[model samples]
Target: MIKSYFIQNKSKDLKSFKAMLMWIIIFTFTTILSFSQETPYYQLPKNRKQNHEMIVMPNLDAFTITYFLSASAGIRKPFVQQNGISPSAASFEAPANGFWEIALGQNRNDNWIYEFGITKSNNRLKTSFLELSRTPLVFTNEIEQYYAPFRIKKKILTLDKVSRNAFLNIGLGVSYLIKSNNKPIEEGKITFGQRPIPEPRDYTSLNFRIASSNQPIAFELLTEVRGKVSERLEISVFGKAFFRNNKYLNNQFSFTYVDGSSKEFGNYEKPISILFGLQAKFNSPKYYQYKSRVE
Candidate 1:
């Protein structure tokens, strides 16, 4: 009886040990599979299988410094009138403007990009001849002019990865005009003592105040596609728009005659613009990647 009892105890111990070993094996296999499934976020190539690492590209914590040259043409229609003049009745309408912009900045690992930049635009109104009929006589006049503004812009956005080399961008920013120059205009002529003389003198100043006390802040949405076209060349295209209030442009103007007489002019509404441009990035891909990591 004693021998039988000892044998039964030994058998029970063996069964318990086997069960524990089985459980250990199962747990070890599960842990290995889980770790294998989650590769390092940056280790996978663009064509890798669908996994966490492949779904979200590693955050490149690096600053990307880019400078681009862009030109854009847009129409500006005034919404408000000034100095007893309606926009439709003005000397010119919906003039064309060309702009140049430069930007410098960095991108965070979270896909947020912050940039400060500047843009300059030169615009001109078409020259035209007009005749004013007064009770005493009729006078002929010609309007010719150009206007330009320098603006400082600050921008912030997040890049939503759409593909290996593409992203959808949403941004917001503010623009402030540093300076503006207007075209010169000649008033009508004055005839005194049977002699015709140039009257009011041609004045050279900005026709409208493009910059106001209130800063022009706007939101931007764009889709950017970037890829390496060559060993040192990367290209991207962006479509952008800006929306803002016209109140900031509320301009008050006063024109004074040589005789010390002046006329006060009210404000005119300014139009917004939608712009598109292409950018080329020149640098070593590894440099960019490393810079991104540092950013």
Candidate 2:
């Protein structure tokens, strides 16, 4: 009886092991089918009509250098002018100027772009007007000046394979006035004596002077449309407007036989400029990765 019982127990153990193996195979097959029916996130269709797209991937580090040239035109107010003259009278009316920029920085794939560079600009304007109608009159003056600015800017590019590149840039800068020239003026006063004699005296001379705080801090908003024109070359059209809370001036007046003094004149106001230019980019070989197809 003991031998028969042991044999039946052994048969029962083998049958139970076989049942477990069958269930394991069924579970694995179900899992495989479920996975095959679903699509992967990377295989999704891309929207090619958008200007910018967000990239999601592991973190990467990249470094690049850039150089650019541009031209701009804008309005500016003189920092100091004559006490009695209108601020507009000393205002710069011309807006045809040119500038150049150079930048260098590091990039992290499509995340961010930071750069520091220097810029130089010219300011020239011409207008005709009459001043000091009461005495010492001046007329038809042409003003020309140049400004040099040092600045730093930061930009973020949203990149997508199916769309064009778009980015936002914010910058802070400071500029110094090099030289300012305007039309010359001369005026005199007459005196009456017992013999009816005439006395000559010069009233005031107009000179544009830059102050110690002549350096102005400015800000700008920039937008651009970008695309890769070639394998290692990129082309873009960008626009920007610059502004500053500080003012430029025209002071240092001279009087005949009198002391020369400086007075706070007009404030530089409403200085606005627009730029439209093309930018080309050259890439290094290390910035790209090669992929292979398997049969």
Candidate 3:
């Protein structure tokens, strides 16, 4: 009887072990199948288009240095030394600036641009105008002056509705003004092929004069209307203003006679003025990585 009882217990235990092992295998297979089935968060409607693609730009990209050279020609249109009458008259600006830009970012509207340019920085625009207008000089000559302005600027952008072809950028900047008179031409004579005339340097005209006093600072504002006119070519109109330092820029030339000698006098005066010009921007080709995933 004892041997029969032991045999029955052993058989019962073995059957239970096999049954448990079978259930475990079935459970594992069911769990794996459920996980393997694709389950998206949501499904699109049936009427949607077959292809939906998006383009992404290099929004988070390293900065690059931008090399640019701008040629601008400016004149002192408002100097009164030779206005033909009265003591003086106020003048406006025809300042042309040649700019070289360096940038840390991709030169987008969100980043600032540092500009160092080649300019006439001609402080003697008035004196030069006086000589040209009064000296009766009839010779062909070139007066090359040197000047430079250093500035930091950023762009504010806007969009247009018509054709959606144009964009506007307004810039705000400040600069340090630099002047040079290393070569002051006084009563210089030039000869045309057949005609020779007196182009006096007239440096003696001013009594209280510093050839080129360092006029070092200013605030500026500028705007650009930009658009793509052709393939890979962009054009823009730029307008700017140097609004500060108004008190230091008087065009009035004072004349005084002492001991039977007439003398012209001026201070360290500059012109606070407006500027307008055109700009061309080149757009290089942009490359992007296309990625695809099935939902």
TM-score of each: 0.41, 0.43, 0.43
Where is the poorest 10-residue window by lDDT in model 3?
49-58
- Scored by lDDT, model 2 comes in at 0.43
Model 1 ranges with Cα > 4 A deviation: 1-91, 125-163, 178-232, 242-271, 283-295
lDDT of 3 by residue, 20-62 (tens): 9999999999998776663221122223222121121223222
Q: Which stretches of candidate 2 lie over 4 Å from their true place?
A: 1-92, 125-127, 130-213, 249-276, 286-295
Clash tally for model 3: 8
Quality of model 3 by C-alpha lDDT: 0.43
Best-to-worst lDDT order: 3, 1, 2
Q: lDDT of model 3 at residue 210?
A: 21
Superpose all Cα atoms of candidate 1 onto the true structure and report the RMSD in Å to 1 decimal. 11.4
1 versus 3: better TM-score goes to: 3
